[model samples]
Target: MADGERLASVTWLFGQPERDSVTEQAASPSQPTTADAPRGRHEPPTRAERASRAGEFQRINNVSMHALARRGMSVAEMRDYLIGREFDQHEADEECDRLLGVGLLDDFALAETLIRTLRQRKGLGRSGVTAELRRRRLENDAIEAALEDLDDDELARAIDLAERRAPQLRSLDTETATRRLSGFLMRKGYSSGVVRAAVDRALSRSGESSGPVFR
Candidate 1:
């Protein structure tokens, strides 16, 4: 038999003898002893079992948090991931809060970093950045901060980006070149005025159509 069954059998066997004595002891409360001790500490979960439970929770938390960090999780994304897997919402919230409180997650900081990366590397525009930040569930404050900083010299950056890619559109006719440049600027989130100015400049430099190519 298993240890638990064996122990239970042994307990059952000795239980009859102890029953009368326990009743007598209970009837007389003049001198209490271990036999008269309340059925606490020895009942329910033992210390080892409690310790094991705590250890399991700790391990689960560590592995999950590390996996999330490795996967580049935002707070809401992490919450959604956990919820999609059937984790209790309250528990997920608690764990997410703990992670955020301990600096394991910072959505605002992440949004700023992403904004810089996309703008500098991908040549994305303000609208694109805002959409990306929204996808990450970042607060408006972070989005606003990123946008505010971008306004300082966005025109210069956009001009530089256009210059680098202008060669690609150069092969096309003047109408095509103007159309391409305007479309590019529009897709990059530039204002209509900015896109028009850039496209005019590009067409002029290309010795192409000076008339507006975009209707």
Candidate 2:
């Protein structure tokens, strides 16, 4: 793809910039204004209206921050959440910037924590974790950085996952066990090679004999 196309694809994930809602026009005191002048006749927002808008934004920000306090959220996730709650996109973006500035939202940190939790607690492989991160709309750099840590331990992790799930399949025949366990590992995002190896190891440990069942 061309550079422009690539950039477009990435930007498509976040949508377009929102238009500003409030527009202000200033008039010179010495200038003569006509009553029929569209520009002169229009009144700018009042101080109370501005304050009310500011308070609304603040309330939205506070609610979002409280949600973040309970658990980490990716910047895109928070922005989308605010937008879904009827906050203007520009205002939502401002709130996201403020939170990010204060370190309340860190995509890299969120990616790392999510990667660890998915792998250790949920037994998700690199592909599974990557898909999850993308679903959360994390930046590509953050996702790559988090996935870097999985390079050395993927096979071992796959084996461990298979081993843990091996017992339930022990009652099945060798072919059935191999098929079931291989499918399970594949669904967890293990590559065919890793799935085959893990299934072989798992079935062997369970005293079942099966040749390579995956290519």
Predicted model with the maximum TM-score: 2
Which pairs clash inside model 2?
A: none
Model 1 lDDT-worst window of ten: 206-215
Error of 2 at 135 (Å): 0.9
For residues 58-86, what per-residue lDDT tens digits would candidate 1 score against the true structure?
A: 86586667766575667888887777766
- Separately for all candidates shown, the number of backbone clashes (residues 3 or more apart, or on different chains) is 0, 0
Per-residue lDDT of candidate 2, residues 143-214 (tens digit): 998888665788999998888787776567888888888999989888899899888887776533442222
RMSD of each: 12.6, 23.7
- Candidate 1: regions farther than 4 A off: 1-49, 52-56, 207-215
Assess candidate 2 and give its lDDT: 0.82
Q: Against the hidden true structure, what lDDT does model 1 obtain?
A: 0.74
What does candidate 1 score on TM? 0.68
